[model samples]
Target: MEQYDIAVIGAGPAGLFCAIHSIGPGIHVLLLEKNLQPGMKLRISGTGQCNITHDGDIRMFFPRYGAHGQFLRPALMSYTNQMLIRFFEERNLPMEITEGGKVFPVSHKAGDVCEVLIRECQHPGVDLRCGEPVHRVENTPLGFVLYTAGDTFSAKNLVIATGGASYPKTGSTGDGYRLAASLGHTITGIGPALTPLLIRNFPFADLAGMSFAGLPFSVWRENRKIFDGQGDILFTHTGLSGPGILDRSRDIRAGDEIQLSFAGPVQCDTFEREFQNIISRAPTRSIKTIIAGLGIPERLARQLPDLAGIPADSTGAHLTAAGRTILIGHLTACPLVVSSPGDLSVAMVTRGGVALGEVNVKTMESKLVPGLFFSGEVLDIDGDTGGFNLQAAFSTGFLAAQGISKRVGKRT
Candidate 1:
């Protein structure tokens, strides 16, 4: 078996960074990845723009990770989004900041980011292998042992950065969870998150292309309100999706009904004035038809008469004050009965992974499994889109690599 100073498994962001940080004279470092090439997921993130990190104060960044926010606070502050941007820029790969302070490559290519990392990990002290899935990990008296296809390797330190199970097409496929579980590490609950919601709302059908661009919506879980976000939302045949919808997806329960709030970015008083304006202009049209044209879709518009207990064909002149009042209520906060969550393959990230308590934040190392460090979505930490996920991978990977260096030294 080849004995190395450090063996980092899963050539994703965390593993690659660990290898890069471990590089120095006389160090024996090996990086193993199951995918045919490294950064497959990175290549597709941000639609290939590779939203690497968000430019913001470290304080606000913590809440974005939810409960795991605290664990990441120290490492996140240490590496920071500013530093990651510099790390790439120093490699001649400049980045650009966009809406929501999201940072991306200048060419909007995730491939460029991946290319730079691969190049950086190519020093003599570092060795990288892809298309290799780790079969098992054995914790030795000193260091650790890793078994992969056709070979077994030994090292004094190991870092696992296999990413999350979401986006299996990128080769995440839950392999990390399996490998970590085998090492006696507890795998936290995992579920598809940042995915679109499927709905049974008929109006959403007609409003399929209609988007409340950067508008806000409230997501309800049973009778309790769960999550609220302000951003673009699009009506689809399935349900609802877009930046805002994806943001609130994790808190959404199976039986929740997604509804747009009237008390949203557009104020209720303003909506009332706007609604009355339209109702007065087209008394010739059915009150139902008139309201449909007021930012509500035809499919959803068609259902107003039923909600108001007035016939769809009933004229505006025929509608009493009661019918008009009832009609407005339905349009203001239309309800969408949710169906199952979108498939995991299409999801952007996983909501849950390895619990935070089990991993050391300063080192990004797993206390339960010595030498087994984790980063990226494999840990029970996920953030909303707009460059949060990529940042976590970059920051945590850097921290984990730094930890491995201090523990194992720079050489074999």
Candidate 2:
């Protein structure tokens, strides 16, 4: 029957960071977790590099959340990239900038960052728990009571830092969603984001183990343009993936066509001109060999002829003028039928959760209930790849903890 000023329902980025914000000399905060360790998912993020944050201006950070990004301005501003970097530096975990402004610890270990956060909870006011599964959250006359199999705890304020439903092995088992909804908060449609795309084409098999750079691709939702970006893309056994494809995976619906403008920044006419003139430089070469050098992956080079309704073996000398134009068009505009996105289990993050409007945007507290706050992937906001998800989790958790600090400290 331990009593505390604040009870946090997770030990991940949101819960732990939130506890850090609120925990001072007098504050008593309990951070709970079901896993044996905190930040198991963080340990594996960015292929184990753990992209800490982006190294860009604020506006560049916003669009990472897609449409819901607008809601994250306050928290992100309150704890910007510079602050995050400084926070790590203060703790002796210096960071460095990777490609696309993505930040990572100079040591390149996600566990090192997690270690600093875990060590931060060593302060007297913070009591962090692991391997504890909280069963229910009940509002008590005093404030809130959280029941776990091991013990029952009461708090003046509750922060649901329980994360999203991606990477179940990482321990985000949609616990926050259930907890928030139980307290009368409305959760939006939840789906996988920043995950890989699943295409049905078998020829895609040939492209497996291939990665491309500087290729542009477009995402569409029933004829309406959703997003487009030029970057590296890779083909896995499951489907198309990489930075450009994962960014689009959030809003992509079922049965959508993933139209790829392989020409990238080069306009269609310019590509067309480049295509026609390219063969002249290698007039004696096979058409497949000539187009293979058109700045695309070698696998795509051989496939373009088949896609253009011309035999791949056909040389530039064998093709008619119409064939040349058709080949150029197919090369510029390669279409991949995106039957579905990669499995949610394999997804990097979740798309939707507790609605932002239902929670106080300023405090991250539940509007329907006092002494209740939510953070991390449980929130409705979703960001694309490149460390935005972790940043969101860290921001909301810290913000909610600040609110709890003010309320609980005054009550005492």
Candidate 3:
């Protein structure tokens, strides 16, 4: 058997980073990838541009990872967004930040990001073997033994950096969950995150390409409001998409109610008062014209009156009190029922993985088993869109590498 000081499974961002940073004298690192190529998903991030990280203070990143943000503090603090940018910059890959604070390479190519990572793993101490998928793993007093189709390998330390179940074509097939479960780790309820919602009887089908910025919205389940936030919302042919819907998709489910405000962030009472003032000021103006003047898209404004059961040509002069109330309701809190959300096949990230309680947050090591660590989406940590997820992956990988290096040093 080929013995290694450390063996990392999956060559995604996490695995590749762990291997790269684990390089040291007398430290043999084995990086095994199932696919023929490495960084398949990384090559396609940000629709090929690869949003590498978010541009901000590291402290601002906590809430981006949802409920488990606090758990990633140590890892993120150890290797911050600034450090990540510097790592690539030192390698001659300059990064640029978007207007919305998303960081990407100056070349605007995700391939460049992958190229740098793959090149870094080419050190003499690292052995990157692609197309060598491990069938199973066994833990022994000596350490961990991996069984592959062609041969078996043993390592003093093992890191499972296999990604989540999103984008199966990129080789993220929830294999890590199975591997972790086999090792007596708890796996949480896994589902799709950062995916679009499919609305039931969607009304804005004709305005599929329309988008709203900073549109305030609320989620309600069985008449109880569960969440309230705002983001950019896009009208899709089937339902809704864009950062607003995708970021909150994890909290949404089938049959939940999504209340949207086309009139920005105004309260119901405030919006009604302002709208009534508009009617008093322009009693003869068409209702559609008044709505369009409120900064709503003309296309959507034209449909609102019809949806409110008022004539498309009705003006404030002829509008009834009941009609005004319905129109104001639609403008303020238009409720849309979610029939379903995009499935795992189209989801950008997986919401759950190995339970956080079983792992050491400071070291990314398995608390139940020594010499075993985890990183990336394989852990039950999923961040919002932009560069948060990738940053988390890289941060965890760096921490795991540090942990493994210290352990290996102690043994040596």
Candidate 4:
């Protein structure tokens, strides 16, 4: 058997970084990748711009990962975003932070970022084997043995960075989940996150290209409010998408009801008073024209009356008391029933993976299986869109490498 200090599966950002940091003059590292090329997903992140990480205070970054945010404290504190930025800058890879605080390569090419990682991982004593997939991993009494297509390899430590089940085309087909489960690790309920919602009987088919910035949205399940958020939302022929919906998709499930409020600056109560004043001032103006003054697009304003059971051509004075109440409700809460979540193949990230409780966030090692480590999307850590998930991947990978190095040194 080919013996090594550590064996890392998958060649995404996490695996590459782990191998680069774990291998040195006295250590031998093996990187096994199923795909023909490493960093396949990293090469296409952020639509090729590759949002590396968000440029912000480290204190504000952890909570974006939700409940598991606290779990990532040790790793994040060990390698802060500032350290990551400096690491890349020192390697001649300049980065720029957008107005929204997303950091991306100044070259505007995800391939460049992948190239740097690939080059660093190819250091002497690090064996990178592509087009090779490990079929099984066994924890023997002496160490761990990995069975691949052509041969078997053994290592004192193992790191699984197989990523999540999103974007299957990039080779992230949820293989790590099965591997961990086989080792008696608990796998959490997996679902799609950062994906669009498929609305049932969508009425805004004509408004497909229209988008609302800073749109206030809420989700209700069985008439109980579940989630509330605000972000940019885009209308699709089948449903809604954009930052607002994608960021909150994990909190939503099939058949949940969505409420979108287009009344940008007008409060429902204030609108009622202002609407009556408009009617008293201009009784002959069309109700459609009056509603258009509420700040929504004219086309959406024209359709508002239809939702309120009033004709589009009706004048302001034509609105009865009941019609006025209906209009106010419709304006405040436009409802859309969700049919389903976006397909996993299209989601930007996976919501769940190996149960967080089974892994030590400090070292990225398994609590049950000693010498077995995991990082990246294989764990039950998913963050909001805009460079958060990638940052977690790098930070966790760095911590896992540190853990593996210490363990291997002590064993030797």
Candidate 5:
């Protein structure tokens, strides 16, 4: 039986990097990947552009992960965004930051980023085995035994970076959760996070490509407004999508109300007065014509009268008091009842995973099982869109590598 210093499962950003960083003069690391090619998901991130990480001080990353942000503070601090930028840049992979503060390779290709990591893994003493799916993991006095389809391997330290359930086709079929659960780790409420929402009986199905930029949006649960933000929204054939809606999808549930204010800066109190002023100026114009002139998309503006329950051909001068209120309300808060979250198969990331309490934040190691570690989406930490999740994966993987090396170095 061959023994190694570290066995990393999954070849995603976390596991691959963990294996790369853990290599040393005496350290022998084995990387097992279920897929034929590594970084399957990374290749498709940011529509192939690969939003690598956000550019800023480490403090900006705290709130981006929601409640779990503080848990990620130590790992992120150990490997700050600046350090990550320098780490890749020093290796000849020049990166650029966009206006949104997202960092990407100058090549603008996620494949290039994966190529760099894969090329670096060719370093001596590191064994990367592809098309090997870890069927089971057994804990032993020696350390851990990983059973793959091909054969079995043993390692003194094991890192499970198998990722979450989202994008299962890419080999992130929530295997890590099952693997961790088998080893006595608590799996949190697992669901889709950065996924799109499906609206029930969506009204603007025909206006699929219409997008509203800087739209003020709100989510209400049982009449209680729970979330509020401003983002660009895109109308899909099924419902709504885009950065704004995608960001809030984690908080939304079936039967929740998603409101979009196409009226922009106009408030309800002022909307009626402002609308009336426009109507007074163009009393002879049809309601559709008047709305289309307000810079709203002509296709969506044409449907506004029907959405507000007003006569489509009614001119501004023929507007009734009740009709005016309905139109004003509809413009300010177009309500859409959510049917459910987008399918997990298509979700960009998963919401819940192994609970945070069971894992050591500083090292990305399992608190219950010694010598067992986890990183990336396999853990409960899921961040918002815009390169936060990738940054978390890289930072945690780096820390886990450091932790394993430090612990094993003392033993050697």
Candidate 6:
């Protein structure tokens, strides 16, 4: 059986980074990948542009990961976004920050990012093998042992960077959860994050391609408001999408109500007053015409009156008080009930994984099992879109490498 100083599973961003950083004199590292090639999902990130990391102060990145933000503070602060940019730029790959502060390679090719990591893996002391799926792992007093279909390997330290169950075609099929569970680690409730929502009886099927920037929206469960924020929203044939919807998808569940405000941040009462004033001033004008004047898209404005059960030819003067209230409700708080979120196949990230309580945030090492570590999406850490997830993967991987290196030094 072959032996290694450290063995890292899954050759996505996390595994590759851990292996690359773990290389040192006499410290042999084995990087195992189930797929035929490495970085399969990384190559498709950001629609192939590869938003590597967000350009901003590292302090602002905490809230992007939702409730798990503080847990990632040590890793993120250790490997800041500027340090990540410099790591690539030093290797001759320049980066650029486009609109919305998303950082990407100058060439705008995700393959470029993968190529750099692949080349780095070619260094001595790092053995990268593709198409080798680890079926099981066992802990030994001496170290850890990994089993494949035809091979077995031993390592003094192990890092499970197998990622979470998202984009399964790239080899992320929740295998890490199983492996972690076998090792006595708790796997939290797993579900799709950063996915689109399917609305029940969607009304805007005809306006599928329409999108809004910084659209204000709120989520409600029963009568209680659970979430209220704004982001770019896209109207799909089945429901809603875009950054605004995807970022908050983790917090939403089936049957939750999504209330969209087409008229910015105007409240119900404010909008009702403004609507009444508009109607009083333009009694001769059509309701749809008056709605379009309030900055709503003409097509959507035209359909709003019909959705509110108002006649097409009705003028503001013909709109009764009740009819006015209905129109205001539609404009201010158009409610759409979620039927379901996009499944794991469509989700960009997984919400849950090995519970964070079982792992050390400062070093990415397992608290229950010494010399065992985890990183990336497999460790109950998923961030919002626009490079936050990728950054977390790299930061955690780097921290895991540091932890493994220190333990190996102590053993030697």
Index of the highest-lDDT prediction: 3
Which 10-residue window of candidate 3 scores lowest in summed lDDT? 403-412
Candidate 2 structure quality by residue, lDDT tens digits, 135-219:
9988868888888987999988899988888898888889888988888899899898888888866456767878878677776
Model 4: per-residue Cα lDDT over 1-412, one tens digit each = 9999899999998899888889776899999999999999999999999999998888788878878889888888888888888888889999999989999989989999998999888788899999998899999987899999999999989999999999999999999999999888988989899999899988888889889999887789999998777899998889999988998888889989998888764567887887789899999999888888867888888887887789988998888999998887777778889999997898999999999898887899999999999989999999988888998999999999999877877877
Worst 10 residues of 5 by lDDT: 243-252
lDDT of 1 by residue, 1-412 (tens): 8889878878887678768877877788989998899989888888877888888786788888766688888778778888888999999999888866888889998889889999998898887988878888888796788888789999888777888889998888888788788878788778888999887644546557767766656667767777666788877777788878887787776778766753345655577677677667776787556756665556656666776688887877777776666665555555667776776888899888787888887998888876778877788888888888878887888898788777665333
Comparing 1 with 6 on TM-score, the higher-scoring candidate is 6
RMSD of each: 3.1, 2.2, 1.0, 1.4, 1.6, 0.8
Model 6's TM-score against the true structure? 0.99
Clashes of each: 4, 0, 0, 0, 0, 0
**How well does each candidate superpose onto the true structure, as a TM-score?**
0.89, 0.92, 0.98, 0.97, 0.95, 0.99
Q: Model 3 misses residue 253 by how many Å?
A: 0.9
* Residue 235 of model 5, lDDT score: 89
Error of 1 at 296 (Å): 5.2
lDDT of 5 by residue, 193-243 (tens): 888888999999888888988999889999999988788888889988898
1-412 per-residue lDDT for model 6 (tens digits)? 9999999999999999999999999889999999999999999999999999999899999999999999999999988999999999999899999988999999999999999999999988998999999999999997899999889999999999999999999899999999999999999999999999999999999999999999999999998999897999999999999999999999999999999999889889988888889888889999889988988999998898999999756899999999988888888889899999999999999999999999998899999999999989998888998999999999999999998888888877
Misplaced by over 4 Å in model 2 are 266-285, 320-326, 409-412
TM-score of 1: 0.89
- Candidate order by decreasing TM-score: 6, 3, 4, 5, 2, 1
Ranking by lDDT: 3, 6, 4, 5, 2, 1
Regions more than 4 Å wrong, model 6:
none
**Which 10 consecutive positions of candidate 2 have the poorest summed lDDT?**
257-266
User: Candidate 3 at 410: error in angstroms?
Assistant: 2.4
For candidate 5, the per-residue lDDT at 214 reads 92
Q: 131 in model 4: Cα distance from truth in Å?
A: 0.8
